[model samples]
Target chain A: DTAVSQTPKYLVTQMGNDKSIKCEQNLGHDTMYWYKQDSKKFLKIMFSYNNKELIINETVPNRFSPKSPDKAHLNLHINSLELGDSAVYFCASSKTGWSSEKLFFGSGTQLSVL
Target chain B: AQSVTQLDSHVSVSEGTPVLLRCNYSSSYSPSLFWYVQHPNKGLQLLLKYTSAATLVKGINGFEAEFKKSETSFHLTKPSAHMSDAAEYFCVVSVGTGTASKLTFGTGTRLQVTL
Candidate 1:
């Protein structure tokens, strides 16, 4: 079974379009995270949720919103996406919210805004 | 504050040759360091980690890293490079110890191995 899975491996949309990326993990982990990799291949943390509660929210714009309906799933919703939003979004999970735990990542979703 | 720096943005080596990827980190507290490898279109995979345990940490795929507090460096090294080892490697540092703590990832280093 895939430990972490993200849908829509590739996304191409026009400017001002809204899109949603879904992520699910079957590792029975309590903490989940969303990371964005820019054109320079710099990965930055966007948001994190533990047990359906928001724990970490970086300086990402309001256009990027994350929702965790349950502990096993964390979804990202982008509103009025801009060209700058073109990058790879990754979903990751750990056993707990502990920083020391190793994160299991999913095959990322490549988002391209035209 | 915590941060990580990958010395090289790209490294080229021949198969069966020694491979080295340099990394430096800074943190206020005893930091947890990690090396993650990402293949094209794939997720990051854990190579090795240093958490104040043994300074020399060995990981999968014949990779290993040594943490040096004096220099604040945790460099990944391998005795022999394989073409399959070509990927992007990232150095990561955890600032704090709790669930709320954030991870700082270094600019990745792309490794290219030639036959």
Candidate 2:
């Protein structure tokens, strides 16, 4: 079974359009994270949720918001998307909030904004 | 703050040859280091990790890494390279002080294995 999974692996939308990417993990992990990888291959953390609670929210713009319906799922909703928002978004999960446990990542969802 | 640096943006090796990818990290506290590989059109896979358990860590696909605190380096090495091993590798570091463990990733090193 896929430990972590994200829906809509490929998304294409025009500017100012709203879209949402869904993610779920079945590893019984307490923490889940969202990472953005740009065209240059730089991977950066965007947000993290632990037990359905918002824990780490990086410098992402207010237009991007993450919602956790339960401990097993975290969804990203972007409003008024811009062209620069095009990139690959990855969802990851770990057993603990500590770094000792390795992170398991999803197949990634590529978001392309026009 | 924690940061990881992958010295080479790209590395090429022939089949049956030794594979080496250099990485260095900086952290205020005892950092947890990790190596993740991502094949084209795929997600990142954990290759190996260093959690102060052992300086030498072994991972899948005959890959290993040595963490050296003195040199502040954690480099990945493989005895032999296979064409199937061609992928992008990321060096990651994490600190434990924060409420949620966040990973700091390197710019990634693209490995090209040729016959």
Candidate 3:
């Protein structure tokens, strides 16, 4: 069984379009995170939530927003997606309270903005 | 703040040869270092991690890393390179104060294994 899963493994959209990517983790972890991998393969954390509460929100554009309805699910919504938004989005989860806890990542969603 | 630098953006190795991927890190506090590998069209997988424990940490698939505090380096090494070992490797550092912490990832090194 997949520990962490994300939907729409491949997404092709146009500029100014809106899209949402759903993620779920069954590892019973309390902390969930969203990371972005650019064309250069540089990974960066965009947001983090612990127990469904927002904890770390990086300097991402306001167009991108993350919502965690419950501790098990964290979804990302991008409004008016731009060309620069083309990248892979990875969802991960780890045990809470410790920062060094190892993360279990999903296969990732590849978003291509045309 | 914490950051990691992967010295080589790409490294090539021949089959049966040893592998080395260099990494350097800087953190305000004692850091938790990690090496993660990603195959094509796959998510990043944790190869090994160091959390103020043993300097040498072993990971899955015959991968290991040494955490050197004096040099602020956590370099990943393997005894031999296999064709399956070709992938992108990321060096990560995490610094925490109390209950809050963050992870910083390196630019990643793409390892190429040739026969």
Residue pairs in collision within model 2: none
Error of 3 at A85 (Å): 0.6
Candidate 3 lDDT, tens digit per residue, A53-100? 898899999999999999999999999999999999999988893767
Please, what are the lDDT tens digits per residue for candidate 2 over residues B25-112?
A: 9999999999999999889999999999889999999999999999999999999999999999999998865557789999999999
Highest DockQ among the candidates is held by which one? 1
Give model 1's docking category.
high
Candidate 3 stretches with Cα past 4 Å from truth are none
Model 3: DockQ vs. true structure: 0.70
Give one digit per residue, the lDDT tens place, for model 1 in B15-93.
Answer: 9999999999999899999999999989999998888899999999999999999999999999999999999999999
Measured against the true structure, the TM-scores of the candidates, in listed sequence, are 0.99, 0.98, 0.98
> Could you tell which candidate, 1 or 2, scores higher by DockQ?
1
TM-score for chain A, candidates 1 onward in order: 0.99, 0.98, 0.98
Q: What is the lDDT of residue A77 in candidate 1?
A: 100
Give the per-residue lDDT digits (tens) of candidate 2, residues A63-82.
Answer: 99999999899999999999
Q: Which run of 10 residues does model 2 chain B get worst, by summed lDDT?
A: B94-103
Predicted complexes: DockQ each: 0.84, 0.77, 0.70
**TM-score, second chain, candidate 1:** 0.98
